[model samples]
Structures are given as structure tokens and as C-alpha cells.
Target: MEYRIEKDLLGEIKVPKEAYYGIHTVRACNNFPVSGLRTHPALIRAIARVKQAAALANMSAGLLDRRVGDAICRAAEEVAGGGLADQFIVDPFQGGAGTSTNMNVNEVIANRAIELLGGQKGDYRLVHPLEHVNLSQSTNDVYPTALRVAAIGMVLELSDCLAGLQAAFQEKEAEFAGILKVGRTEMQDAVPVTLGQEFSAFAEGIARDRWRLYKVEERLRQVNLGGTAVGTGLNADPKYIYAVIEELRAITGYGLARAENTVDLTQNADVFVEVSGLLKAAAVNLSKIAGDLRLLSSGPLGGLAELKLPQVQPGSSIMPGKVNPVIPEMVTQVAFQVMGNDQVIAMAAAAGQLELNAFMPLIAHNLLQSLELLINAVNIFSEKCVKGIKADEERCRRWLEESHSFITALTPHLGYDRAAELVKKAMAEKRLLREVIIESGLFTAGELELIFTPGELTRPGVAGAKLLEKKG
Candidate 1:
């Protein structure tokens, strides 16, 4: 069968019509049949760094033809400027250690360069994907380099989103400062705490996770791009490594350094695994926060009744006026998926055996997917949940005032035996602990009030309720 020819800007490159069935390539030919997702902004930036590194490496080694080097650099600029970025499409998921992805970029750049010179795709008889576009590079080196660049970009955005979430919780902290609620352990009321303190704990957890992610970002800055195929730099000049590292640093504004042990770099992808693990930890924390929100907002009149979440959507088709903590629920689901993806990454990293890690395609897919989901989840949680949360102040106050658990605070003053007896009587008779204490003649009304100031029980102070505060 004669293959139908599609002319690329380069000239006439013939892709087996059947081979273009991959998601990215097919989508590029279909939806963006006219244009694509505009060459992922992160990818465009990465390719620019790749070209810059390639040019610097070639120049330092006296192997660069000035004319071809100039053309490659120009093409890189055009791609970076969003020209032809739409032409490259290889599924973010693929095998071949991202060779398909690398080739997609190479083809687009080469084709665009050919157009600049009045040629066509596959007219690469002059400027070729392997010859000029990929000089001194292998998928082993280039693929990981691009992944690092893209991961760094994602980390930056994720960090910003996390900061926004932290700020949202912090604001809620101040807003709910005066509202007290029952604190629970093992799903049972254990003590008194202000709603503000609860939000602050959530914010602190996120802050710690954000710092961990930032630390992981540093690992991505040390790329193994100059390692070439087997990490021996077999076909590359010795000086190329240093030069490429310098150029990449310049292009990316990241503190990119060459791997000290390129051979180990080629053999182990534990770095990616570590990053995914950190992300999993963050996701777990997000899940915990979401779980708390769901539990606190479990029912408006039937459950804990301590806090209220913002209503983002209707909770039921059959039960009108029911609002669910859907935002947190979605965040919880994203967290679970991210956690599972991290396990997949760990297994893939462990599966790396001989000289080359062949599981990078899966690693990249998992990492990218985790980042996208986490970023979106953080945005939704902050916007729809944290920022919109309201304390059920009256309900919280009533729970605190009516709780028999508060009698525990009086133990230090009345002796444990007396306090226990009073608590038992209050629970048996279904009377308020305060009323039981006053009626039993354990304490006068003034002394009872002094011993049971809810604020002091919630947060310790030096005055009226010191013993109660200590017990709490």
C-alpha cells in the first residue's frame, strides 16, 4: 500500500500511516489536527535548554559546524517562542525511554528549521533529527534531561498552589480563633480546643510537606543529560559534560549540575522514586486533612455538629437541602490515586536492573499525573473548602457547655473518686455535668464557674482554671 504523504515544514517525511495511532501523535493529527496543546510550556522551555546545551557542548569540543549550530540554535528559539510547538505530539505515556517524545520534538524543530530554509520535512538530507537536531545526544540523556526540566517546572507550580492553600488555612485560623469545639481522639471526644487551633494544625502539616517538596526539587536540578547512552559518554567529548551543564544552568536558571556518577545515574532512577515518595507523603497529609473536614462536617444536625464546610455542590438527588463536603472528598480521591501512583513508581524504580533503567516512561507518566492532580486538588481544596469554611460557633459552644467530659477537668480540684462519681451520676441521670456538680454540693456555683471556664479548659491560662487546664 502506498503511504499517504503529509508534508512537514521540513520537506516530506513519511510516517507509516498506521504508526501514527499513538494518543499524542494521533491527537496532534486530529484535534490539533490543526494545532496541539501548544507544546507544553514546560517542554518548550526544556527543548530550548537541550539545544543550548548541545550547542555549548559542540562548540567547546571544536566539533560544531558553525552554520548547522546556528540553525539548530535558531530552531530551538523558534520552538521556544511557540512556533511549531503545536506539531510535536507523543503521548505523555509511551515506551522507548521517551524516545517517541524526544523524536516528536526533534521532528518538529527539524521541520520548522527546514521551513525557515525553504525545505520540507524528512528533507533532513540537510538538517536531520539525529544528525543536527540531536547531535551528541541519546534518548537516554535527552529524555531524562527533559523530564528533570519539566519536573522542576511542575514543582514550582505545585509549591505556589500549596502556599495558597496554607495561606487560606492561616486566614481561617484567625477567623475561627474564638470558637471552641470538642477535640477527639479515637473518634471520641477527648478535650476542648478552639477551631482556630485545628485549622492551624492542618496549615502546619501542609507547610512541612511544602518544605519537603522544595528539598526534593533540589535533587531534580542535578540532571544526567550528558551521560549519553551508557553513562560512559562514549560518543561525546569529555569537555561536553561540563559545557552542557553550564549551558543548561544558564538556560533554565536552575542550579543544574552534572551527575558525579553518570554510570550509576543511568542504572538507577531512585531519584524519581524518592520524589514520588515525597509527593505521596504530601498526598497522605492532604487525605488526612480531607478526612478531618469530612468528619467535622459530617452532619448539620445529626453528627459532631462542630463545624460547617462551604457548600460547593448538592449532596443528594433524593434528599433536598443536603450539602456534602464534595471538595474535600475529591481531594481525598486525588490523594489516594497519587499514593497508588507513588507505589507504582517505587516498584518501577526497583525493577531497574542492568545498565539502563527501562521504566522511565512509567516514571514520567506517574510523576506528571501526580503533579497535575495534586495541583488541581490543592486549588480546589483551598478555594472551595478551606477559604469558605465557617465555624458552627453556637453548636460548638453548646457541645462544650453540655459535655460530661468536662468533668474530667474538675478531678484535680475535687479528687478523682469524687469527680468519677459525679460524672457517673450526670451520665446516668442525663443531666449537664455543671448542673450535677452544683447539685451534689461538690462545689459552689462561683467555684464551679471558676473551675470550668471553657476557654481555660480549651487553652491553658494562669488564672481561674489552672487545675482544669492541667487535666485537659
Candidate 2:
């Protein structure tokens, strides 16, 4: 293996001759080995876009030569297009408020631009990482801006996934629209409801999440790119400060705007906290819906067998023919992980001090991770679980027939006291409520049959009251 000497403030080190990264990135690679996980590719692409935008902004403001800006733009575009993702070797969990990641991008772009300009690698005279590529920007601003871009992209993807999942639920609702099942409260039977209504509730919950995720993009669109180090636009040309964001908007095609209060934006990480809170809300809803599906599909014989989830794999190594709700179980675990990541984001956001948040790396890492996880989880859940779910009509009907809760339908016809006595007697004898009603002689068989029909029992109002009066 051949090596080239690259020098930094610390000293000189040997770098791979073919590598696009430089001394600073190599130092970061050696220094942080905490997570074994590298920075996300989406985030790296965002950083490249920021650098390209800055170079154009500088050229427009006369801060950079046209040739230098052109070379930098070409190199940054290569990075943005995912040509040099392998060059970003820094871990996601690092100190210095993501300075390592910022420097990694700078070094990669500088070396690539040097190559483009017909200059040798590590030749700062042609393309200096800090003086040329990373001019008029600080990690404090660049890192968070890139984070916002990456997060917003992921949020859009998650919204699409959620919408698909919601559609799957709606289809299931239509398929099971007339299948009657006993609703439960406190794990006990309460009343009759159509399986379709239950699926519609699931669809509504996911629809709400999709709307909330779309709104999150609005909050994330405000960035502090031109704020420089401490959000005062220090050392940054006024024209460049305004021009950079426009360049960024053109590059990203997002409604990204510079924050009005640059200093406040630099200091406070509340926007990230709000995004994390929204993610937590979605996670909570997903976990709850997954749990309900698991319960409804619990057992084939011993549990609530109203639902039969699609079986993609064989369950139980020792026990024969024991299928499990593995997909929903997997989704529930993902929700748990997203909830945990949200907590990490909150703590890191709150840990920011006066000038800038030193925990930007942590926040960026966890936020992007949660978004990716949710996207995959929702898509998988829709395809593997919700869309393939089957209704056990026989089991559901059996539960409805045995439930004493249906006696509530008789209250308006037979009066509350009489209904309560019938329910009590049914439970005491461990018999169906209709049997007790028959023996009580409260009404003729025809009237009882009319009251106990599926339409009369499930819907509101006494459709059988006229029958009762005619028979009496």
C-alpha cells in the first residue's frame, strides 16, 4: 500500500494516495470509534449541497474567484450526487458539535476539487479545505442546516409510507365492513361493533400522523446557514449571507429560509426538540395500534381469535404449527426504538449552551435514524400485516353470541331493571343472555328474535320496539 504525507496542526501523518479524505478526516476516524456507525449518506449529501451553495454565494458576492468557485461547485456536486460517500468516515457520535463531520466534507471536497483543477492532492495552494471550500461557514451553522435538510427529506418519505399504510387499513375496513365483532373494555366484552369500524379507527390514526409529519417540514425549513459561528453573520459578507440561502433553496427545492433571529436560532435547539416530539407522538400511536393487532390476533383457540395475521415465517422451533404475529411484533420494537431515540434527541437539544449546541451530532444522528426506521417499519407493516390481515367471522360471531353486554340493547324495550336482572341471571348460570330472556317470559319469541338480530343489536335505537308493542 502506498501513502502520501498530509500535515495538520498536530503534525504529519500518512494518508492513502487514492483517498479523497485528508488529515482532519483521518484524525476524526482515529479519535472517535464510539458507535461503529458512520454518518448517514443523506446528511453527507446535505452538507455537500450547503458547501456548493456557499461557494456560489461567495462567487456572487465577489468573495471568491470565478474559477475557484466553479471548481468547488463541480466537486461539491459530485459529493452531493453520492460519488464520495465512502470518504465520509467519521462516526455519528462525536464531540465538537459535529465539527469532525464538517471538516470531513471540507477535506473531501477540497481534494476532489484539486483533482478537478489538474492539481495534485493535498495541494492547499490550489484548493485549501478551510480557506477555499469551507469559506464563510462554521460547523455550528453548517451541521444543523444539513441536519434539517436530511430530516425534512426523511419526513416526506415517512409521510408517504404512512399514507400507504393508512390506505391499506382503509381497504381492510371496506373488506370487513359488515363483519360483526364484540368490542371490549378492560379486557371484557362491552358491545357489538363491525370489524370495519375498528380498521377505520386505525386508518384515522395513521392519517393524523401523516398530517403531523407533513407539518414538521415547515418547522425544519428554517435554517441558520448564513449565521456563521454565533449567528451574528460575523465575518460573512452581507450580500453572501442573503445569496447563500437562495442558492440553497434552488439546490434543495425546499422552502428553506434563513431564520429571522439568527442569534436565537444559533443558540436554541428547540426546533429539533419539536421535531423529536412529533416523532415520539407517531411512535406512540404506532405502538398502540400494533399492540391492538397483536391482541386481536393473539391465539387460534385460547385467545381472541377475531383476526388472523399473515404468516410469513414458521413460529416456535419446538412447538409444531405455532404461528406468531411477528410483523406487528417487529413494528412494536421499532416504535420502542423510535421512542428511545426521541428521548436522546430531547436531552441533547436541551443540553445546548449559550453560543451553540455542542450536541448537534447526537441530535442529528438520532433524528435521522428515527425517521429511517419509521419509514421502513410503516412500509413493511402495510405490506406484511395490515394488507394481508384476515377476519375470523366464526370466532367473532361466537364471541358476540356469548357476550352479556348485548343485554344493553334490551334496556329501552324491557326497562333498565329488567335488563339488569336478565344480565345477572345469564352470568350466574353461565348461559347466553337470550336463553335467560326466553325463560323470563318478558316478551314473545318473535319480539325477542327481532331485538337480537344483527342490525338491531349493533345499531343505535330500538328497531324492535314496534314489534314488542304489537305482540303485547
Q: Pick the candidate with the highest lDDT.
A: 2
Q: Mind giving the per-residue lDDT tens digits that candidate 2 earns over 1-472?
A: 9889999878999999888899988888899988889998889999999999999999999999889889999999999999988889999889899999999999999999999999988888998999989899999889889999888899999999999999999999999988977988898888778898899999999999999999888999999998999999888999999999999999999999999988888888888888888888888989999999999998889999899999999999999999889999998999999999989988998899989999999888889989999999999999989989999999998998898866777778778888888888898999988778878887666776667666776666775776667767
Q: List ranges where model 1 is wrong by over 4 Å.
A: 1-13, 16-48, 78-86, 460-472
lDDT of each: 0.76, 0.90
> Which residue window of length 10 is worst by lDDT in model 2?
443-452
lDDT for 293 (candidate 1): 89
Error of 1 at 114 (Å): 1.2
Candidate 1 lDDT over residue span 452-471, tens digit each: 55466665553345544554
Q: Please give each candidate's TM-score.
A: 0.88, 0.96
